[model samples]
Target: MKKIILIWFFMMFSMIFSETNSIYNTKIDMKRYPNASVVTLLDRESIIFNKDNSYIIKKHIIKRILNYKGKKASSEYKIKFDKRFEKVDIINAKTVKISKSGIKEIAVDKSKNIRIIDAPSDVGLMKYAAHKMEVIAFPAVNEGDIIDIEYTIKNNKKQKISGTVNFASREAVYNKVEIINIPKDMNFNITKFNWNTKMEYMDNIAKDRKIIKFSEKFMPQILDESNIPESLKFMPTVIFTNYNNWAEYRDELLGKFIKINKSKENLQILKEIKEKVLDKLITKDMTNMKKEEIIQDFIAKHIEIKYIDNLLDFEASSPKEILTRGYGTSLDIENLFLLLLKEEGISGEIVILGSDKLVWDDVKKGIDMNRFNYAISKVTIDNKDYFVDATNEFSKLGESVIENNIGLILDTGKPEFVNVKSIEKNITRIEKSYNIKIDLNGDALINKTIYFYGINAIGEREKYKYMTPIMKQQDYQKELGMISQNAYPISKQMDVELGSPVKISYTYKYTNFASIDGDFIYFDLPYRLDMLDLFENVRKYPFELVSDILRKNNISIEYPANYKVRIAPKSLEIKEKNMLIKRDLKIGNSNGGNKIILDTVVRYNSHIYTIEEYSKLYKILEKLNYPKNAKVLLEKE
Candidate 1:
């Protein structure tokens, strides 16, 4: 009887908020995105900028659940806000379930389910300003239910930062609308990107403000597939900013940094610090490379760099304060190094850049300053430019921690942008050598050595520098297990230095790595340079490779004295548009036994290719995928 009464109470309570709202009255066409489990029924955003420069933003989102994946969408909702700059309030939220019988509505109980938690609000780190997010989980939502959410965010601190609203998402969008109301006195530039659907724009004159609106419907989903270009490059987006050009944005940042340096007290403080560094870390006879090594090591060890968000904490802290704290942000650490270099009589400047995959296109099309999300130091030694960042403890001198080898250098004095190249030859190469010995009983002992150069060396050093011996052994065994079973490590060694390639060597014993059938033995080759196997299907866009990839492999194998070469692939050399692959396999005699040797080299000369070139490349990859094996006959001669 109590259970029945509880169910009755829920049924009656759900009816309390059953009054139909205009948003819920809208219908959904399920046939549009048949494969989509959850469909965005409606997405609306409205922004109002008053004469006082304050901003008021309201957002409404409605989603329909079609299957199990859609049910995950109905589970909860969260809205984040920075307490110092913004306030968020949920105006209305509810879930509706429709079936053949009728429609059931359930209102979210804000007082009961909604709770605030301390979370990172945005990508910026402003610790003094506490950030929080309100998370609320819906009650009793099932498949086929529709969720409706509405909230408003008001910016109390009005700054000159531009606002960007992106209308495209991975999920299918049925309708999206954005409305902006600004006073006539305000000046703003509107830019749009990657818009496929037709957009309707309208301008209306209000008594106190000018209203601009943009609306679009039936927007298709943006698919994110493997090996495809970044979604941002193809996603539809609109941005509003008061600044007109990159020069204006550059000046603003320059002013902020210049103001910090102009203080007489700050200048004296930097001078004293630089004097200390020069006295302790630099010598008159030391080369630039040596000086850089010492200074980079000192900063990386002594100063703890914290990268919380894009905005570095050093932007606010004084040099003295940062040193005293023993912890600085990316900007702070770089700035300190710049000042130290200046005192040492070396000239350098900050290079502000964006992700290579994101910034170059925009920089050519009027320069979107917002794309510049990172900063590094660019210095000249012997008339050649080098980029460096001291933020990473594991990075060697003259290497950028960000690893994006492309961006724009901020010519501080001229307020101009200069392209910075991440020299291709500086980033990739691999050399692998394998030695294998197979016993008559099919057991084998294999030794492998890998040498990584340039960026690859840096990456490998960072990956394994902190791992324990046992952890490293486990990881090594996991990779080996993919080709053979019962892989036992006999020995392992690693050699790392600042100026040379990293070398990793290991020896393993495999119980049954080779198969013995009748009077023959067979084993698969290690590290085949086959490009076709890496890509199963051709892509719409040309495939990209790590620029300047160079790989070489040398393999030596020995078999029983009774064995002789029965079948082996002939040596082949193929060179085509930007790629070269050559293999030389030889059979010879050593100590009255059969010895087989394989040496191969694979080189990719270019970083990117056009579809026409890729089509030709694809055909070559298909040929490379064919199996080539060596079979040794065990019959005595």
Candidate 2:
């Protein structure tokens, strides 16, 4: 009996499928109730198969147009089916009907092989209603069978209106499906779109309003053995306008302005202002004071900067306001400085730049614009160029602010291209000497003096913020100990200080080196320490090729008294071009005591060397650690 009932249901569905070409129009009235109203329209779709295992889809579109507008809206709808069947189901029909005070729902049966029409709530029903009519058809296969689908849309309204009917089906099985032999007054638009053929790849389509069509051949998984029987799933996306247009729209809404350059006139005004400002600030009576000194003093006394505020409207304030406020952001100070320099007859341009820490390799490709962050000023003095950033309180006048490296400079007067020059790594060297007396009782008294000189000193001081208190002390001790292995005996009497190039001088005493094994006197020669250890284990990766490194060191040793040396005396000499190490020792006695002297130096031209070159240089230093004369022996009576 069940089989008979199923067969009868299939026959009835097939009959409806044969009439798939029938089109229906629906009108929705939204004013039936005080709060809301509704109306529904239904349609049938089918796929007809031939004996040759080929099939075609016949789409019948029924639209339920809703005209609704109110402070609040409500409605309910229901749809019924005689029997359930596979490949013949509602695309969007689910859930039981409910009051639409908010969004309600409609229910669908699960026993039917309907792929869609299972709306959990009223929102789904409304979405089904809003969908265009052309997407209502089912895909067809090569096998001979008829598919019948019925669906309805409801809207709460009383208005009377008419809507056009349209239908769509896959072109793979059915080459073309359209409303043929229609009236000439009907208007329509046909557009072609493309889809990604790759499987498992998410393709984002519909960034703009366009319909995409996919071929069955493009999706092999959806095809059957003969490549004729299969099902394809396509996403239904609508055509929407571009969203980026709103940015330009907002700009246009605000207003536009043209920039005019009065170069000659502006230059004269700038020159007059510079002279007046400098004359009042600089104490030098003569016009020929050193530029570095004048700029340094001016920056130290006048330039005041405050943390930038989001609400700050001006990009730059006037020089008078900057001086009065004593604080501004990079943009504010740089612009003000440029104005002052221009007033002083100096040709300066504002350069836009990315912060030093911000890498620009990819950003230069122009994917996005937010990569840029900081700015500075470039001044040409007597044909010499100098870059300045007044934003940094500690930065010197001629010093390139570390954060402003490689930043793009925007020139308002003339858009001339300006490049930021790279900074050379700072190298410092300290040399020290110790004089002491060693008695037969294995007791020694020592006095030590040290001298520091290099760019490394300034770099170390600049990095003080990154070091903990204990780490800083340890670092300082390690640095001082480099002059001599017995650094604990040395007390730092004077701290490091900066002058033109920066210098540090200190003195200390050691009482621990009094014990000796021989009656005559003996001492092990200090090993030569290479500054190249600073570059150890650094070039482990390919991307570290261009990073720069700084190296600095100080060494000191006391001359032994009444000493017998078996190895030759050792000495190292480092100059701008090459480094040389030589060791030779001989036993000797002096008026004060036995004396032994060891010297070594590893001279490098500059700290700025590429990773490849640095690796090569490091190899040379590694060779200096040869086991030659690593140990020395002395005799005593």
Best by TM-score: 1
Q: Write the per-residue lDDT of candidate 2 for residues 1-637, one digit (tens) a residue.
A: 9999999999999886454323111122233221222122333233222222133334433222223421011112223221111123344433221123432233334343233344233222221222222122222211211222344333222111111112222211221122211112222122222224431211223433222222221111121111111011122111111112222222221121111123465445445555776667644443321443355356545765543211112233444445566755555566656565544455666565542322333223222223234556777766766666655434443445542245454533322334454233222344554455455554445554444333334353465534676775676677657745654534544344444334444444443344456454344333555544444634522222112322332223334544455554354443333333333333345665665544444343322344465566566556655555444444562
lDDT (10s digit) by residue, model 1, range 506-566: 7888887667888777766665664722463555554555345678899888878787777
**C-alpha RMSD (angstroms) for model 1:** 7.3
- lDDT of candidate 2 at residue 593, scale 0 to 100: 61
Per-model CA lDDT versus the true structure = 0.69, 0.38
